[model samples]
Target: MKRLLTILLLTLCVNLSAQTLRKYSNEFMNIGVDAAALGMSNAVTAFSSDVNSGYWNPAGLVNMEDKQLALMHASYFANIANYDYAAFAMPLDHDSAIGISLIRFAVDDILNTTELIDSEGNINYDRISKFSTADYGVTFSYSRRLPIDGFNYGVNAKVIRRVIGKFANSWGFGLDAGVQFESKNNWKFGLMARDITTTFNAWSIDKEEFAKVQDAVEGQNQELPETTELTIPKLQFGIAKKFIYRHDFSILTEVDLNIRFEQNNDLISTSVASINPAFGFEVGYIDMVYLRGGVGNFQNELQIDNSEKIGFQPSIGIGFKYNCIQVDYAFTDIGDQSVALYSNVFSLKIDFDCFR
Candidate 1:
């Protein structure tokens, strides 16, 4: 009860302290194409799998061995170049792994035109179409176990870029820090600090002349241009437990309490953070096949706000394992304003156990 109360108090404080909500950043675009299956469904952390361990819980890299490497690619739920991402992790020695990820969100071709007044009112002409704005990010990560027992940590540095025709282009940096722990009984605790830096020169405001026209209409000589900076969330706390049922069957569940703070201010803000509960089980009487299903919230690419929604994202997956190699695939629903789309998540992971 005390733990629960502490959580409630933290949440209340977060909500009351925030003054304004943040707008979108390039990082959100790729987050929509969250692959690694269980990571999306359960708000995954401290859950260790060779492939997604790079993105979800870096500390899980402690589980990697045999000079292992895992790669995953999510095709994205929508075909509109919304959100797509790919990640890979390679382990060396004990408690150490190297990871990399790439993400992109492209706004498909959009007609660029200006209103033209003709004799019969206003007629729009083919003003030539250019690819809509796009955002991309690349991440490199490293993780290791600490000298303390049952403790491990990781960090990631990312390069972010935004492109919007000839109008807006910017480059920036972001950082991530994560920690994880596992008890003898298999309980898990995890925390991650995400996008802790400010990416600068996020947009182009060379259209000062247009602003002047608008200012003339508004009767003001000066107009404050929108801030051309991208804001990213600060923290995410995650927890989960693994239940090994029978000899070969197992179940996993997790939750994440995401918190965001105001840029350049001490204020903070939060929402329920959406609850993503996932379940998985093994198939085949011999435990060679794995089946997975889950639900959770995923960001939208076009929308500037990383709003939270519930009961909308769902996933189903299947996996096959032989020797030390595993191949897995998952189908996910991508919800949107107009129509919800679908995507495929494919992963490959190789594991080795010295004691086995």
Candidate 2:
């Protein structure tokens, strides 16, 4: 029974990974909720210092000295899907902070179809059904600055839930840890371990629900099966340097490396293992307005013309800050123009202490 369960879990993980455009299970956890991070191609492991750090690198939360609230929303594939996030952070002391965050991704109003024929030999459209699919997560985080200056560490505990209409559902749990280091010269380094303990999702299916649909169809040969999925751990490393001039203008450049332990056939030929790299740049003017851009997800692909091409995704974004409120926008190109290929994200952040 143990071996059978393991095989079933692996199979489920592979299917979910394929459907979610990720190399591992629980791909929704990999989505960046901060517009600032997405606009910078998710190279903010060392640069996230706001409330959204709860989702990026919890260690960055130690940099927050004021209570903050942040909210973000994104439309994927031209509104075919939606992603939303919210976070709140508060300092427990001079060197410690706590945070809570929520993330949700959903695809709604999907039409369910059947192939039952009427007496006139025509397909019946009378009994159409609709359903939605959604993924949700809640995270609790804590960060503390070490007694040694310029160093910080943090951890996040999360609960995840997913539902496909009412036919199937899952419950998952995971842990993440991160560390950040800054140098006197302003260079920064960061490391994050996502799903450090291997996230597990136990799924239960309503066979009766699927059975009804199968009965509606003329010829069905498959039955619904319940299973579990496991998301393996991944490590991210980042380094960044900032150039400041005239005390009014600054440019920050960062790079990140993503290491995955799962076997990826697409990247096998390129190296013995899969290692994805990302790069980002941000230009700030007096801390009021900012411009950002980045590229990531390097892959080798074959073109329709029988040519080899290296594929990468690019993103751009802008941000504005006034008083204690900040607004950000980002546009990402996911390489598919035909089917919801572009993603637009917007975020707002407020610092309550700034008013005082």
Candidate 3:
């Protein structure tokens, strides 16, 4: 019986790794909500104070000031909508905080058209098909603060899915680990290691692309394999500082680091195992509103001459709070397109702080 149990456990572990291999690239879902609000600083895992943090940094959950539940939704300009971010914290008997969260991203209504071709010049039109990419994902998180000092820890497991036209569909899983620390009087810091395990499972794939097996790896295309395993890299980190002014105004600046062992087909694969860093600043005023802007070096390092400027991701955002509900929004530029395709984010939050 002991041997049987051990074998089963080993099989489960192998299966998990196999799942990651099936997907081409664990294309993370981050459509509707502004990546800036939480991702401006190299994926914003430290935006831990509100519901958005549940998506960006689940480890922040341990720092919740009160036991509460929150729900938030946001939309982006490219017909993308996200339904996420819910967390309920319950202070355990020993001052330890326990919390759970749900996060998701979705995009839809894309257009696709195909041109018919005469396959053999027989005047017979060839079959044509078309479609757009659609994707969604969900993740669950648990977090808690450590006692005896100012430290925290948390974990999250995510399930992702995506489909495009009639060609492909895939699903995958991801895992995250994070920690946070603060001082008695002045300093605060956070770090989150994301996608410790990331994978994508091939759904329906583009038959056309798959059919022509490339001759050389230099071609930069897919090659048939006995099995395809998606590449999920390691390590993403964040750090921050707070500046106080009087009692109502303050400035918080943050810098984050992200490194990845990218897949062969990933957008960032060319710079595999490279560290991409970012910075953000939040200025608070009137206690009811906030002004924010940020930039990342990766953006500038990746600037394309004709695509867009990459010097920075300058972002502007605002937040409003009244009694028990708070709302936040931000606008960002992806260095793509000169005028039309700039990205934006909208967020709505409800808190029961009145009762905390």
Model 2, span 264-352: residue lDDT tens:
52333334457788999999999999999999877667779988677778899999999899899999985651223888899999998
Rank by lDDT (best first): 2, 1, 3
Candidate 1 Cα errors over 4 Å, as ranges? 1-23, 27-34, 38-42, 49-51, 66-78, 111-129, 198-201, 204-224, 230-232, 261-287, 298-312, 323-325, 333-344, 347-356
lDDT of 3 by residue, 132-158 (tens): 445556666677767748777777777
For residues 1-356, what per-residue lDDT tens digits would candidate 1 score against the true structure?
A: 22422332232222222323344444453253334443245466656545455566566665666445555565444565565566667676676878777777776574433222244555546533343657778778888888988888888787877665443456767677788988888778888777666443344433642332332232333333453455555566777786666777766666665555533211122253332233323233245677666655433333337553333466667778787777777776635322446766676766654325
Best by TM-score: 2
Q: Which parts of model 3 have CA positions greater than 4 angstroms off?
A: 1-24, 30-47, 67-107, 110-132, 200-229, 262-272, 300-310, 334-340
Backbone N/Cα/C clashes per model: 0, 1, 7
Against the reference, the lDDT scores of all candidates come to: 0.56, 0.81, 0.54
Candidate 1 lDDT at 325 equals 73
- Identify the leading candidate in terms of lDDT: 2
- Who is ahead in TM-score, 2 or 3? 2
The C-alpha TM-scores of every prediction are: 0.67, 0.87, 0.68
Clashing residue pairs in candidate 3 (N, C-alpha, C atoms within 3 angstroms): 21-229, 21-230, 23-200, 23-201, 168-204, 169-203, 169-204
Q: How do all the candidates rank in terms of TM-score, highest first?
A: 2, 3, 1
Of the pair 2 and 3, which is ahead by lDDT?
2
Query: Poorest 10 consecutive residues of model 1 by lDDT?
Result: 263-272
